[model samples]
Target: MFVLDLIPAPTLRDVADILFLTFVTYQLYVWFRETRALRVLIGLLVLGAIYSLAKMWGFFLTTRVFQILWQVLLILLLILFQSEIRQVLEKVSPLRFLRTRKRSFHGAFVKSLIRTVFELADEKTGALIVLVRNDNPDEFIHSGHTIMALPESSLIKTIFSRHTPAHDGAIILSQDYITQMGCVLPLSEKKGIPEQYGTRHRAAVGISEKTDAVCIVVSEERSEVSTVTAGEIKTWEEPEHLAKQLKDWLGITESPSVKPKEYLKLAFVKNWGAKLGALAMVSVAWLILASQQEVKIDMIAQVKHVNIPAELILGPHSAKSVSLTLSGSRNSIKALKAQGVGVYVDLERLSSGTHQILLSAKNIDLPLGISVNNVRPKSIRINLEPLKKKVR
Candidate 1:
């Protein structure tokens, strides 16, 4: 009998959250790839890495640049990925990315691709067909007709046919189905686009830039079958090779066939990867949560035997920079909100042996999110003696 060890296992809830967030990140990847902003993203990532290194090594300037750029980047990202962001949200009508996207056979998807290529090459029908990958093509599909799913060969041939309704626009995909025809995709906005690039070629590059999807275009003017990925297009003629390429990209080609024992090892490793990723995410989440918590601390003015009065409490002393030393909780190390607590001691009134004063603060209940572990100086102790007379 084999007994499974659950020791050191991470919680399932954390795992699920990790996977869901991972899937969302994947979808975002597809959305961001191959676009103008993709280069910027890479540059930013590189800069971030450099900043991390600089901080480790004490290169203050590099760290400053990285920190400063972040201030402007948020606005720029929104502007650059405007269309793509909208397209992705539209595709996730019901938030499917919150869980795993189960793979189903996108049948007829390949056949249609093959047929379209053959016809476009033979008859020189300028056409583009886009396969939605990690991102959604809904925004692009809005410009065309939403049809019931159709067989690939028939759909491709008809779309390229001279008399067909969608001959001018691109075909769009969703969930392994041919969901739309004659879809209007954003045109390539790069200034260096070829002089001869017509609507079809531009659309192909445009969609490829904006999404991780594979786009196939048959150039009517050249009788060429070109594939576009990450905003770059490449041409080819071999149908068999193309089929193999599709399968490989979609991961149907030669998946590692491991033995049961090997499979167990792989699965465990995969789960470990997932757990590690989750822990990283959890750390970030914890920081965000801790920041937002009502966790607060109050600084205590380290004083002895001096009774603080109402006047000092209401106003500041002659020294603009007051040196206060007090403690309430761990949060006190960096922050002590005025509303959380306040104290003022009458520095002149002290001729003391020992004195006790009640400590008070507003909302000592700690706003909402943080718990106070320890209160420093539960009683202020003052050791007092009679004031000595000054010699004339």
Candidate 2:
């Protein structure tokens, strides 16, 4: 009960405000998850929490250090994550979802891709193939001659053969078309790569890490087929599993194994923890910044004379307006309407004479949780002249 008392009662506006904040926080979480800057964001959040705790518990020294550290950290983060920040901004564009790609990767094209990959692997010929997804990989790839031919097993095999001049570089498959061949791709610089993985495998991992493209690398020495996505590599020994993964990634329809309702339920349950975490973080931030903190604001309230006697026709007073001091939670203070607030003076009880009326909290109208702290010109003196009777 005490804890509930500490928090102001929830209103419809409060509910809507918090819900909007939660939605924004969750969307930000989703965007950051796709970028390499997520870890940096988490580190900053952790430091913020520490700073808040230090200030709350009177750890002045630690609080001061963090205040200075934040400035330096911000500069460093901007310098280090410039590209990642740009990528995140690009992801936030609403038009991106509306722009759809013309996909030609059907069952037939997938089958051709499978055949071409294994055939090259069986011949111990090194090959690299990039399958473009939603993200355009043109910025990361260069020096490729455009082909734009239909994806066929024989054609793909011929291009990757040791005899062809283009066999040394990679081929890019976009939608249903072989967009380019002999394309130079960036190589992964990440340490801990296996000694067996050659330049082809490194290039596959590199491109996949930078974009959403799937890279398939065929090892010439081992005659193995491996797929790289999001900087991770997996060797596919079975054709069925590889086909299933490719279909899932490329948005190909498959025979349904579960009901529609069950599929939706599984999708919701897939990342339940992350979704809950985003909501909880938003709630805590709202509580600290808006719900608990109290702020004071000064505003002017116009004086309004009500229920004046009919016999009293004239009035002269300096109490045309009064300055009011109000205090409440930050949100409540922000929502106050200056025009709606006024000091009402009751004149029905007084006779036609010079009289003074006291102004207090009772005379002013205010919203819930907001209280009038002080009022200037605490009392108003008015001179009411008696109405003169005119001869008829």
Candidate 3:
């Protein structure tokens, strides 16, 4: 009989970990590549670098100013990237994730889709496809013709070929299917989109603002490809480069798996620089609650043993020592003092063996056993001189 391999594979685990990081790094990178906030993000990084240098060099005042600015910059980035982040989250939604890989990527059929993109780009074809995410874009889809899912290259080429019946309008890519063709997205009227950007870019930005879907544009005149998410679009991108970008945004990467470290990093903030506002909000909540509650009250006191002159039977036998501490309402605690607190046990009643005691303060009272359970006392020593037994 052959024995099974019992040894751990260190190399395999390391490979798995690295592969996880590669996927995460790529995913984080792609999500930020084309959005309008990329510049501001760079600026934030520079500020962070400066802040780090200031900290290292003991420039406390300069670092303090940077710290404040960094806080604001962080919030703006979140608002700026909200649309793109929404799109990526839609891809991660459980209902959409497992069901769409066959149609979206990994399937050999996607190769045909890539081929069609190349063909469109080579011929300087202009087109827009707005993918609907999570929340239904039924209103947007109603504006266009409905179609059953079709094979990649042929159908994509047919629509944008300049010869097809619906070439003028944009396609709507929904989970596992292109549910409609020629969908008309409301063009973003906001001034944020540059005037030089074409309708293709406009539609990409528009649909992204309205929904969490990513928009891909193949510019006919420029022969350039761009993607829009979260109300921001980047143009003049190469088709190959855009492919990697989408793959990363779509949760595909050079590595097929995820790692614990990457998952944790992604969990807090795929971009930590962008999450301080949320943290500040939490801090504000804590402050508000703290301001309303009791202050300066921390502990209560308890008795250990009792001493009496009447009982001659006093030896090591004594009730367990109880610790007294300051506690309760602010006024009560403020008035309390170690002198005001006193431990008392009825020695006449206590048997020769042991007895419980009471600890009382200006307004505080503790049950017989509570004090010892709570506080560890430094010392509670009671010496008793037995009451002179009247010589009878």
Candidate 4:
């Protein structure tokens, strides 16, 4: 039978547990996709596959080696992806709310940002603007003039003008305000960045890689606008497209009319490869984890004699224990072990004679989702004797 058929219907808690695991897995997949940790994750998965196959095929040496590695895998992951792990913890920190409150950038702010970028692009003036999200970029801002002024298109344009002192540096915008200007951001050390892209583009990507910030960069050489986030850059050819992207990232929602085909095309057809890959990975993982529901394990349970008749005595019992095989999910089996499972033979109403008691499925007490499949030495022979009167 299939695993799902063998398993009982899920409870509300079980559903919640599954949903929580799925959400965590999806988020981790997304996070790994943008970092150097992705390659490490792929390598680990490949090793895991090999290990599984080795164990299945009875490659004892390989299996033993992999088993040893599994013991330290958690520590190895922690040491290898320490930075990524720190970033995740920082993002989920409760103290973050106390440190800074995130204010949604209004439509006016998005429009201003878009206008400023296009105006700078037209003048062939290089500008880098970093929009701070949950993470604070204050530490990355060095040798910068702190203005903490409300953002305006004219002010932004003036700061990045060719003649201005702050023109060469980046601007930091936080909580819908320009927190700093003329800020020097870290240059990206990542390889494969195009040689043609100058310090401004590198700074944009660098700050984005370090924090959850949306960076907008304007190229002086090409008069082009681009967005850098999560170490990825996308250049925009048209001002309208840049503006739409800015609005989308800045939480400025615009309800535009869309046809059914257009909706389908955007949702499914675009980036179909990534969508399909994600679905396949999640489905495979779920199946492998859930298939343990049908797993069976054999255990020996000692038979306990309970509630003996006062006038009778158990002279001899043929079978003191029975071999039992149980089928259930891994978790259920673990719980059964923890709770101390056992088999019991009741002999309270038996008369003074030898009798054979047949064991069956009904004789065992198991937890929900667990079922008894087979019991060895199905019957136990017991000889009972009447108690003789004795002098006090």
Each model's C-alpha lDDT? Answer: 0.61, 0.80, 0.59, 0.79
Candidate 4 deviant stretches above 4 angstroms:
1-27, 58-61, 71-73, 87-116, 133-135, 139-143, 150-167, 186-196, 209-212, 229-248, 251-272, 278-379, 382-392
What C-alpha lDDT, on a 0 to 100 scale, does residue 365 get in candidate 3?
49
Put down candidate 4 lDDT per residue, 1-392, tens digits, no spaces.
Answer: 44454344556775676666655655666666645777778888789878866864679999999999987998988997787788778756778767754445766677667877888898898899998877778877789988888888889889998889988998888778898999999887666788888999999988887787899999999998889988889998777777777776665655477999899788767656666666666556555555454668888888877777999887865467889999987767756766766788888888888889999887788887899989998888878888889989
The TM-score leader among the candidates is 2
Query: Residues 1-392, candidate 3, lDDT per residue (tens digit)?
Result: 11122221225654465445545444654555555545555576467667766765679899889878878877876787776567667656787756644324343444455566667878888788765555466654446788878647777888887888788788876654677887777676546566667776777776676576777788777776677887777764455666666666554565457899999978667756445443443344333333223434334334433345345655554434454444343323334433344455545554443333333341234322222223334433443444456676
Query: After superposition, which runs of candidate 1 have C-alpha atoms over 4 Å from their true positions?
Result: 1-82, 87-116, 131-139, 142-158, 161-166, 172-180, 188-197, 208-213, 229-232, 249-392
lDDT of 3 at 110: 41
List the candidate numbers ranked by lDDT, top first. Answer: 2, 4, 1, 3
Q: What is the lDDT for 270 in model 4?
A: 66
Candidate 2, residue 153: CA error in Å? 4.6
Candidate 2 Cα deviation (angstroms), residue 235: 4.5
Model 3 clash number: 10
Comparing 3 with 4 on TM-score, the higher-scoring candidate is 4
> Can you tell me which runs of candidate 3 are displaced by over 4 Å?
1-106, 122-124, 131-136, 149-158, 161-165, 173-178, 186-195, 206-214, 229-237, 244-270, 294-392
Position 385, candidate 3: lDDT: 41
Ranking by TM-score: 2, 4, 1, 3
Q: What 10-residue stretch in candidate 2 is worst by lDDT?
A: 1-10
For candidate 2, give the lDDT: 0.80
